[model samples]
Target: MIGFVEQLLRFASHIPTFHLNVQLLVDFAATCEAQLDRWGILEDVDIAIHYISEIVTNTSNGDHDKLQLALSSLYRERAIYFGALDDLKSATEHGPKPQALNDTKHTSWPSKAIHAGRTYLAHGILLKDTVKAQGYLNKATDLFEKVIAIGSGNIALLVYVCESLAWMCELGHDAGAEPRLRRHLGSYLLTDILDQQNNPRVSTGKHIGRIGFCYLCLFKKGSNQKDLENSIKYYNIVMNSKAIDKRHPCRCALLIGLGHAYLYKKQDKWAAHCFKTATLLEFAIPALRMDACFSWAKVPNIDLVEVYSNALKIAPQLAGLEYALSHRVDNAKLLKNLVQEATKAAIAGNDISLALMWAEQGRGIIVAQMLQLRIMFTHPGIPIIQHKEPELADSLRRATTSLHQLDALMGTMDVKSTRKLHRDGVRWNHLVRKIRASEKAQLGDFLCLSIEKILQLGRKRIIVIINAHGDGWDALMIRKGDNRPQHISLPTSNERFSSLRKDLFNAGLRERRSGDGASGTTGSDNTSKVKGRAVKKIGAQPPPPPTPDSILKIILVQLWNEVVHPILQELGISVSTILP
Candidate 1:
């Protein structure tokens, strides 16, 4: 068959008639598509698309067979193989020739239904048009019912139908029909039970993982104990099943689902075990490992803060990892609460030095270091920045600068320029890593000052920390010579800050409108006000008291009034002596 197709291509250039030449190219493209369908050759399918485009362009509108071939090449073969909907779209642009041809053909009802079902499945899954996908799937189901009514004993056709329908059901999940679709999924999976187990082709890891995922989806859809049990059963079947490819990405997800099931079942030990095992999967991507580690950290039975800490180190800078965590984890609280708990643990063990080291290894390393500096500088007798080990401070400053550079590279590298500077980034990363490791080893625990140690170094004064987050701020206080850190709730919330900013923005808009309204009066004050508003509107400078520094000053006074002054008063300090 391959040789015959090659011969057709070889003779094409020798044909004299332009019409015949175009027909030969069409034939060649159809042959290549047939080869692709037979052998699943993606590269051949790509080549076929190019040829089909050429023929469809040159062939006249009345060339039904050529157009039909092009449509089939795109809608059926190429779209399915490549998962790119552009060809399907192009095929649609060529009219419904392929669908018309399929209707006229003498193929079996089951065959036609499965083919149509697959085309719709590709459209739905790839194009993300849930409504169109679902509508076509319904049409496919009716056709499949007719095929079954004809008493066809085709196991392959039945399995294909079941698989397509199962996928549509899964797709409907994101469209918010999860519970209803999951109830129907069991029947579809049952249709392929024999094939899934005994048919060697159907028993591959990918198929098994899909079946497992259906159950996992159901598990997530329900809160009952039975849902958890079923999820665990199916996931275990996939995990423990023989001859399945362990390196597949779906296996990572399957493991994560299994871990979540165990967690819901109150099997904390099992859940932790599953998550840790998922993290160790050699083939799993870093994003998957990041999730596994984050989930593992949330399990109360495990004290693997170091594992969570390390996972967090790379999570924020990686876009996909950050997105995944944003959906499933309270990342801000996770880091803050973890820090607080680590600090308490260290205090309990009388090893505050270890707590400081832990900070440098995790998500808030830079922030923790800055806070440490604040604690040190606020001490009455502590030496100034330059005087406190000048060489070490300089090295730290350089390391901090390199860290900032690394962040910029991670956040801003365009795809076109990445290749050019890829080697440079790697070298910079290696150098930075080496420097940090050396600093940690040489400075040991003292690289980060323990609150107790810092407070003891100077005059007896209390150190207060206000950690701001997206949702709210956390305040921690440590008196000089105190062991335990005191947690205080801040008066300001994210909502309040956001509301304040919004009001200020509205006021700016109002001022700009007022300035514009008065500008035409032709007075100097009005002209000056209009000019000032224009400057502020254009971001030349913020309008007067609404500047960032002014906002900060306002917030500082409010904080002192609401929390700081009250604490000082409680500690026997005169509130009148303190200036806000």
Candidate 2:
């Protein structure tokens, strides 16, 4: 059957009728990729892809929308393989960009603009060029809107519409139409289950999750309560879904999103509950758990110290061990809040050990807090996996090496790369299943440094930490042989501290005066991962324009009166002890 299909491709160009014949060729190529070792030769995918390109090159306009959409999907399907290959390099270090489907034609069935739009969006995501990505997004936005205006019955199209909108918002662009359809997604989706006779598609949790995200984006920009409600509704749908298991990693993020939404609604109890739940889900990835734990601390009137402490205890994975020092720094920066909040919780509870641990972590002095710990161990290193499954690791390494070498020479619709990508993808999938079956390492106590390690690093030095998180500033004094760090509640407000930090950065004070103990004195710890991280703060406000001298004088006076002088007076260190 495969051999006969190959015979047709050789003389396909001569055939006057194109659509059905060409689809057979494309379908065959897809089959070969799906089951390469079954019947078809490896070169068949290459030939099919090549032939499709020639046919599409001539079928540029008018009526080939269906064909174009099919080609686009094929392009996207192959792109996923590239993304996977790129991701495999993440076992220990970040990998370089993988090969993309660069040869996909701009063809989409004219009637199915949404399909074409989707293809463009997929291709755009693979491209590094900002302008091109935006262009593709814009085209997708237009196509989605046109179909939506006609009120198409293909409910699946509705999900992509919301996805495109959310993606556009992420890119700092908006078509001003997200709320139109997604806001009332309940009206469209009567039942959470995808009845095969109806849409016949599953993964409703994720589909609705996208709709929820669209609403989330809308609420962020406009502060519309309705949008917030819609987002919360959709997120809740996913959370309560029967088809989506509780252990699904995607639910972990949904829970966090739910936590944030509830927080915004002034429903502190629900918000805290959601965050606590997300933090405790052991099956979830460690990075997300860390984020959930961090969010859990921000909810006022909630004593999540136990939860936070538990999250810190589970460092079984290698999230923070990224490619470079800068990567580590970024990772640490991500969880700078985890450090700040941990310190605050410690100070409130008078837990000296937690205070010292967070103090060091927030200073970004010790290795980056698992900040860049986004699940995938990035950076393409040559070391084989050192786990018990050496043979499996060796297989993974070989697959990665093969993909890495071939990625450099491949182009769009390149069959060779596609076949290799498929093979590796299968290997990776199998490896994942095998590892899951073989993996037995459980969560353990990890984040806290031993007393000996801290003492060695400090060398009897007094570690003074000024933490400015939540409502006010806190100063912790870590001395040798003390059961706990002495916590001092400072007079400086959290808002004042953030503004001051911002001002110092603007005026180059932070850069010029490095290693000052005041670096951790930030309401945010300067994170940009979550939008409105500052605005969400109880008394947060924009920083006043650069007033270097005034800011310096205020900070110095506060330090002297509230921090320095008090410490000196208590320790009996007078002017004589400070003589240099």
Winning model by lDDT: 2
Query: lDDT of candidate 2 vs native?
Result: 0.56
What is the per-residue lDDT of model 2 for residues 466-534, given as tens digits with 9 covering 90 to 100?
787777777767565444456667766767657776786777755454434333434554333233233
Model 2 bad stretches (over 4 Å): 1-139, 146-154, 164-179, 182-202, 212-237, 240-243, 260-270, 281-300, 304-319, 323-334, 364-443, 450-475, 478-484, 488-569, 572-580
Q: What TM-score, over all chains together, does every model reach?
A: 0.47, 0.49
Error of 1 at 36 (Å): 21
lDDT string, candidate 1, 313-387, tens digits? 434323211122232244444455555555444434544444444433343543443343334334432233336
Model 1 whole-model lDDT (C-alpha atoms): 0.51
Per-candidate total of colliding backbone pairs: 0, 15
**Top-TM-score candidate index:** 2
What are the per-model C-alpha RMSD values against the true structure? 13.8, 15.1
lDDT value, residue 457 of candidate 2: 52
Task: For candidate 1, list the clashing residue pairs, or say none.
Answer: none
